[model samples]
Each structure stands twice: as C-alpha cells, then as structure tokens.
Target: MVDQKTPADAAASRGRGGAPAIRERLTRRKPVEELVAETQAAEGTGLQRHMGFWQLSMIGIGATLGTGIFVVLGEAVPVAGPAVILSFVLAGLTALFSALAYAEMAGMIPASGSAYSYSYATIGEFMAWVCGWCLMLTYGVSVAAVGVGWGEYINELLHLTTGLSLPQALLAGPMEGGLVNLPAAAVVLLSMFALLGGVRESSRLNAVMVVVKVAILVMFVAIAVTAVQEGNFAPFMPMGMAGVSAAGATLFFSYIGFDSVSTASEEARNPQRDLPRAIMFSMILVTAIYCLVAFAAVGAFNWTGFADGETSLAGILTKVTGTPVWAVVFAAGAVLALASVVLVVLYSQTRILYAMSRDGLIPAAFSEVDAKGTPCINTLVTSLVIAVLAALVPLGPLADATSIGTLFAFALVNVAVLVLRRTRPDLPRAFRVPGAPVTPVLGVLACAFLMFSMSLSVWLAFLAWLAVGFAVYFGYGMRRSALERV
Candidate 1:
C-alpha cells in the first residue's frame, strides 16, 4: 500500500510557489546565530560580544557626525534659511523609520557586513547584489568626498596657524586649479592602514575624533546662539516648500552614516537588545545636534552669505564675531573631524566589497585576508580608487551620486521590511517597525522625494552609474552568485 502524507507534510515538501519559493529560499538562507558565527570567524572576535552599549553608541556617533554638520550647513541654510532646523527634523524622521526597519533586520540577522547581508537573507540574490552594489557606491564616494573636504580644511588650518600652506596645485582637486589633492590622498591611505590594523584601533581612533568633533559643534552652538538675531527667522520659508525639500535632501547626508551601526550588528554583544538602542539613540543625538547647529548658524549669519562658499559655518562665524579665532577653531575641528569620517566610510566600503567578494559576486582579490585578519587587499583597492577620485574629480557631482545611491538602498530596505513581514510572519523578529505598513510606506516615499529634489544633472549621472551596476550584476554577479547556484 502506498503511504499517504498529511497536508502539513505535503505543504512542507513544496514551496508556496513562484514568489513564495524565492521567499522560502530567502527565509531558510541563514539563521541569526549561524550568521553571527560566520561573521566572527571572518572578522574575528573583535566584533563579537566584545561591544557593549557604550562602545556601540560611540560607533554610531563617530560615523554619523562628520562632514554633514561642518559642510552641509552651507548648502542647507541657503535653501531653508532658519527653517533648516525643521529640515533636519524632517530628514531625521524619514531616516528614523528606515533605521527602525534596519534595526529589526539587523537584530534578526546579527551580521557585521550590514544591509547587504540582511538583504541576502531576507530578499533574493538579485536584490541582494543590487543593494550591495549601491552600498559600494554610497560609502566609496563618501570616502572621496570626505577626503576632498579634509584637504580644504587642512589648507585652511595651515593658512591660519603658520601663514603658509601647500600650493593649490598640490592641495586642491584638479578642477580647483590643482593637479591633485595630496593631503586628501595621504589621509585616505592612512585610514585604510588603520582599519586594516583592527576594529579596536579603528573604534578608539573614532572615539577620540568624535569627542573633538562634538566639542567643536558645541562651541559653534554656544557662541552662535548668543549672537542670534530673531530677524533672521523672519522669512523662514523664503525659498518656500521647494527649498525646504531641497534642504531636506542635503540634510539627509548628515544622517547617512547612522546606518553604519546596523552594518556592525553582526559583532554586537546583544544585537537584539543593543542594536535598537544604538540605532535610535544615535539618530536622536544626531538630530538634536544638527537642529541646534542650524538654529545657531542661521541666527548668526545672513542666508545671503551662504552663497559665498560651501564652508559657510566658519565664514559666518568670522563675520558674526569679527574674530578669526572662531573661524580657526571651526576649520580645525572640521579638518580633524572629516578625517575620521573618511576613515569610517572607507572601512564600510571595503567591507561591503569584501562581503560581495566572499559571496563570489566580485573579484576574489577583495576577499583575500592578510595576516592581521582584515581585508587588506580590499581596503587598499578602495583607498586607491578614492584617492584617485579625490585627486581628479569635483565633489559636488560625486556627493550627489552617493546620496542618490543611498536613497535607493534606503527605499529598498523599507520595501523589504514590508515584504518580509508578510512573507515570513512566523520568523522571530528582534525588533519590529512600530507602524508597520505606514512607516515603511512613508519612508519609501520620503526617500524618493528627496532623491528627486537632487538636480537633473545628478539624476543623469546616477542613471549612468546604475546602468554600470546592471552591467556588472548581469555580466558576472548573477551567474557567480552563491545563492543562484543554490
């Protein structure tokens, strides 16, 4: 007699079908503990239970509080006037929704490489590759952008202190009438070496730099606040909604690196407990700092002055107080603080490539580990690319490109949160988005809106990069992908 199986057994034997099959495959891809184990084996125990709440918080702050406050203010104040404070809140809210969603996924997966790994386990191979590709775009260009900013600040500091500095040809980018930014390239290389040394070194370095950066920000607020003229806020919406939205788009960069905390989830001591705290705390802290800075900056300087340069904060301070000392301090803080940002962003970029390489989506060289147990080859390769870009390219186009790629990744994570909720409801989630469909939906739309607010030129360049990504994905990533083979 033929044996008959029960309904449950039958259902278990075959997948839910088509999309369900993919979802089932994704669901069974890797368990939370197993992913943690793999990450520990690769990244070493440095990231394991070694991180506590304080350390995690530092990571978030160190990564998020960089060029945004120092430089983005110049771009934003011109657009939103004193209302740039509101723009920070708007961007923070949107980032918060996505951060919560990432917290859920990060807690569930407990992986170090970040959203790339989370997408792999929740979404399919194609989407995973796309997200990884976009992450590379986000962090790599961010490194170059920060490096370029660093060069400018270093130049300013030298001029302030010694009354002498490197020639423009050696200190600035080619477009700025320089052959290359040597100081920027040197910092990128230095950061790469520091990262390759170990995460502990990286974190400690980050802690020290973060403290100095925050101190400078506090100084800006403390001094600028006292100089506030209420009249500055009179035409709060001078540029109107369009300008506010434009400012929101740029302000989003200030919150960009907050997600790096999620990337470090695999190494968290208690990701389910700590990841949520880290992500939320970091966002709230950054939002508060940025809003205060905006309030003080607008009150201290006329919005009309923003058009003079991208480094408006220091310039405004010079005008408001008529003291070069404040400008010197601000510029010095920016110079030092932006170096750490470059370090952190470059680290993230290399690791993403390392993850992709390990997964066989990219060249194996990226996966090669050195005696120090870091992806040295990958980090060096990234540093080389960033240095070259910093030496030759203008930051405006590249910065906008990074923003576009990041927005795309953020939008994907929001959608993936909803998809995973419906498809794998039984799966244990350490954290769940509070408003479910509403939050994720709004997150997607907000990211899209900001992405659209970028110039037409940025959109065109982003499209070109996406086309290149598609070429890479289809040409090699698809066939070689481990998930595809599975």
Candidate 2:
C-alpha cells in the first residue's frame, strides 16, 4: 500500500528516460575495466593466441622494411642529400616516442584495434571512432602505395632478367599517364587471398618473406660497402637543417609498420610481455638497417642519382656492381618483401574494422569469424577497397596521405597514454614508458610537428575523409551501437 506504481506508469517513466538515451549512448565511454574483462573473455573463447615474440617481431619488420626504404629513398635523398642518414635517425626517434606509448597501452589493454581501442577505453566513443577512421586511412592507403612500389620493382626485375616489361600504360595509374597499375592491383589481390586463408598460415609466409628481405638488404650493404666513394659525402646538408627536418617527416612513413605489432595484441600468446619487446626490437632493428642502407647507397652512388631512379636501391646496386644481375636480385627480393607488407597491412586493416564492428560502430558482418578464426568478410572488403586504390591512384600522393594519417594516429596514441596514466593510476602495465607524462607529451608534440610538415593538399584530403567518416557515424554507427541498447 506504500506508493505502489502500476506497470504502465513504470513504462512511461522508461519512455521519458529514452529521450536522453541517444545522447547518453553516443557519448558513452567504455571503461578500461570493462574493456579488459571483455578482452579476457574473448581470449578465452575466440581469437586464438598463437603468436610468439619472433613471429610478432617478424610481422613488424615485414611491414616496415618495404616501400619507405625501397621507394621513398628516391624521394627523400634528393631533399636531404647524404644527411638523409640523420633524417632516418630523427624519424626513428619520433617513432620511438609513440612506440613507447603504444607499448605501455598495449600491455595494459592487450587488445586489437591498437590506438582505436586505447582511445575508446580512455577518451570515449567519439575519439575511438576518429582513431579508427584515421587507421583505416593509414593502412588502406599504405597498402595501395606499397603495391604501386612493388609494381615498379616487378617491372624492373622483368626488364632486367627477362628483357621484357609491361607497357607503361598498364604499369602506372591514369594520373601517371597510364590506364591502370595492373601489377599493383594483382599484388593486392594476392595478399588479400593469403590473409583470408588463415592467420597462422599468413604469419608463416610473412616470416619467410622477412628473412628473404633482410638477406637481400644485407647483401646489398655488403656489396655496396666495397664501392664507397668519399666524394658522395660532399654537400651532405645541401638543403640545410630545414630540408633534413622535411626529409625526416617524409620518411616517417617507414617507421609506421611497428604499430602493426600492437594491433596483433589479441593474437599474441603473451601479449603483455612480448608486445613491448617486439615493438622496440623491430623499431631498433629497422632503424639500424635503414641507417646502414642509406649510408651504403649514398657511398656507392651519388645522392643525386637516387632521385632519378624509380627503383633506388636496385639502381644503386646496379651502379655499384657494374651489372644488372644484382639489381635483378634486389628487385625480386623487393617484390617478395613488399607482398608481405601488403599482407600485414591488410591484416591490420581487417582486424581494426573487426574491433570497430564488435563495438557496434560498423556492420557486425565485419566481426564475423570463419572456421579459421579470421574475419573473412572484413578482409574481403578491405582487399577490394585497397585493390581499387592501387589500380587507379599514383604512389606520390597516396604515400604522403598515408604518412599524415599515421602521424595523426600516433599523436592520439601518445595522448591516450597520458590520459590513461592520470585516470587509472592503479592499472597494471606490463611495460611502462620510461618517462611518465614527459615521454608521452614529447610523443604527441613530435607527431604533430611531422603532421604539419605534410603538404596542404594531403591535409585537405585527410579532412575530407574524416568528414565522410563523421557522416557515416551519424547516419549508421550512432543508432546501431551496441552500447545504446545497453
């Protein structure tokens, strides 16, 4: 008798609450505790943890040791001259700040989606969506750009070894006065099918390709060292400090593959321990190799010569050896190596979408896994999109856009680390960034500085892409979010 309410009255009260529910849901934050619990539950049920440190490290190396070294050297060396060696060091330092941040967050979160998942658990839904959107731009465009670079190497190999090559019209995009880059599209499709096959199988293949890639680079370094000319070192900073900074920003794209390691957090057998080590190891290894290769290549051939060669590394080898045989070998190695990069990048893109889909930010179909425990539909969709880009877009613009998108993602990752540390001081991190606040602050600043160094046109394209993402979020993601129902 004490103020009992009827069922209809309770229903009316619920309806009143429903009015604000959309706003509340749209802004809802996924707490780190819940994210951690969900990750544990998912690990117990799906997403097998099979990757060890070496396999994961190989993935990072495989993704990173491709286009930036093979193709970007041609563009960057021309700007900074032999001082491109310092550019490599600067870019590695910038990448290391973010890598350290990623290591801490990855150890704490131990989930896929990398920065996007970190953002959701710390910053809220809106920022998570933004990070995920930027990642899509980064991985998607990178796959295409790397594919185009692979096509160039393939043509160089065929022309050198077989005395035949695809016609220029078929080997380049329409923007480059060609109808389509058939080889680029073909490589993307191949990598797509390899990824769809299974994660374990794809990892095995990537590991093998990584070995081949490292071997060829070592061979190039060994041979080119014998032909070093001190004359090439003159005018080392021809364009001065500004150009070195600019070149470092341009070459920042090379360091991006290390984050792919963090994306595999859910698949790592011991993510908390292995991820941080793998991230740092791969970054250090790649940086060392980059510095060595830059030094060797410039010493073997004039830096100005690199600007004129599409296949820069191979061209340097050819000039050093006084024959095309070594260049052909390098080209073959590049073709195989870049294919691995495409595989890893494409896998990263699928897994990121899978995470977003599971959060109800995208279609649930994307998160659907097959018997092999891979997101088949997501892989297929990502492959198709990347294939189109590879076939029709030129490499220069796509490469710049990829760098901007990646830097944006890196900046957010650093910010996420700082926020998580402040908000959840009690959370256990398997790997902590060396400096609290100081390290992550510098990481954020470094990423921002590089981002601003990008061309204005690339920024405009990035903004347009984000605008489209916002439209999709409002039109579909907001209403469909699983948290809304909760």
Query: Considering every candidate listed, which one attains the maximal TM-score?
Result: 2
Q: Residue by residue across 36-98, what tens digits does model 1's lDDT show?
A: 667767555233346667677777887788877787667778778778888888888888888
- Native-to-model Cα distance after best TM-score fit, residue 135 in candidate 1, in Å: 0.6
Model 2 Cα lDDT, one tens digit per residue, 1-486: 112347665445443645434445455677777776776788645577899999999989988989999888889988899999999988999999999998899888888889999998777788789899999999999999999999999998888898998999999888989999999999999998898889999999999999999999999999999999999999889999888988998899888789999889889999989999999899989999999999998888888776665537887788778898898898899999999999999898988998899899999999888878888889998899899999999888888889998998999899999887877788889999997789999988988888887778988999999999999998888778776665
Instruction: Give the Cα lDDT of each candidate.
Output: 0.77, 0.88
Off by over 4 Å in 1: 1-37, 40-49
Clash pairs of candidate 1? 111-266
Error of 1 at 49 (Å): 5.3
User: How many residue pairs clash (N, CA or C atoms closer than 3 angstroms) in each of the candidate models, in the order given?
Assistant: 1, 0
Residue 212 error for model 2, in Å?
0.6
Position 165, candidate 2: lDDT: 88
